[model samples]
Target: MKVQNKIVVVTGGGSGLGRELVLALLSSGASVAAMDINAAGLEETVALAGMNRGNLATYALNITDRAAVEALPEQVIARFGAVDGIINNAGVIQPFVRLKDLDYAAIDRVMNVNLFGTLYMTKAFLPHLLARPEAHITNISSMGGFLPVPGQTIYGASKAAVKLLTEGLSSELLGTNVRVTVVLPGAMGTNIAVNSGVMDTLEVKGGEAPVKMLAPDKAARIIIDGIENNRFRVLVGADARLMDAVYRLNPQRAARFIYDQMKALLPQ
Candidate 1:
């Protein structure tokens, strides 16, 4: 579905990729309802919208809160008159530790934010999307969703669940007007670690090579293109693309390769 005249709702719109998606959608002539947990960050996103600000609405929301998520479509429809699509872009990563050493609190937080958050947003807006002549749902998974990273196993698990959930949703919605897409993004230059409160624990050794990350703006563009074309899956960044092929060819080798690249960031 084309987004040019549609009203799209984007979660995690406070900062990072979510903020970029809001700006990009506005530039593409789409009205947007941008949602985030940080009111200050949402304000910043609005300021960044400038002249396009009038075409956008900001909502400070926690997607993991089912009651709040369930009520969001009404508020967005009130602002934009109708809701055509939703992007479930909000998520959190676990601390860079092996699962055996990870706490249940951290595990639960990751699952709640990544898996349950996406589920709630999808369920809440699905009915509205179904009512529209054309509608869409986009979920952001990660490269870790399909490939293993030693320290980020649980985070990967959450994303892997999202990957399947999105695919399943697409299959179920097949013959319906609502379309679904799953995005698998590689490393992106965003403050997810600081936001997730796991930055302090994701330390690298003194002489290690700095990992390359894709710009969030570029990642947002790829995702928007996917929504416009109604693609079934979108992969962001060359790293994500290459890994998808490598993992498809040999899952064992891909696992080992990622472990080597990430082992330095793990605790000694």
Candidate 2:
């Protein structure tokens, strides 16, 4: 899809990759509606957008709230006439813990924000997307979606769901003008760990993390390219692409390899 002058709504646009994407889209001449549960973060994103008042708008929203998400299309249509695309980027990561050791509330939190939230947003916006001659949906899955790690069982599950769900959407939307793209991003320099409340309890933190992390701007560039080119699956960063290859070669062996790598990352 051509991004220039198109209306795009990005959930989690307040910070991290979402924030970077909003700025990147603005720079590319796209009109953007930065949606996030974090009102302050949305404001910060707007401030960084810099002198693009005509093309940028901020909406504080909880993507997990079904009613509000359902209302978003109308809101966007009211302001921008129509939407060309949506980036389902709102997500949260649970603290590192095995499934057996994890609390019910933590699991619920992760599933609610990471999985169901995307579902809600997709369902809400799909009808409107169908109205357009061509439309794009970008769902942010994770490297964990392809290769599960030991400590992040719930998060891995949620992202894996996103991966499959988006793939399925692609199949169902075939013959239509809508396209679905799922993005699996490797570890990047962002506040997702901190904002999701996992940083404080992360077993490994800082200094040469196991996966090579990219700056959000770099990731954003790759993502925008995928959307413009209508890629079905976008793997961000070398680590993500490498692991995707490993999993495709042998899912069992890849899972075991990732577990061993995770064990090595833990503090002695």
- As a TM-score, model 1 comes out at 0.98
Q: Residues 1-268, candidate 2: write the lDDT tens digits.
A: 9799889989999999999999999999999988998999998998898887568888888888898988888888899999989999989988776677779999999999999999998998899898998999999999988788888889999999999999999999999999999999988899998889887666564544665679999999999999999999999999899889989999999888887767644434
Q: Give lDDT tens digits, candidate 1, residues 1-268.
A: 9999999999999999999999999999999999999999999999999999999999997888999999988998888899999999998998999999999999999999999999999998899999999999999999999999898999999999999999999999999999999999999999899889998887778854446899999999999999899899999999999999999999999999988899888887
Model 1 misplaced stretches (Cα beyond 4 Å) = 207-210
For model 2, give the 10-residue run with minimal summed lDDT. Answer: 203-212
Question: Highest lDDT: which candidate?
Answer: 1
Which consecutive 10 residues in model 1 have the weakest lDDT in total?
202-211
TM-score of each: 0.98, 0.95
Candidate 2: where are CA atoms >4 Å away? 205-208, 264-268
| Candidate 1: residue 195 Cα off by (Å) | 0.7
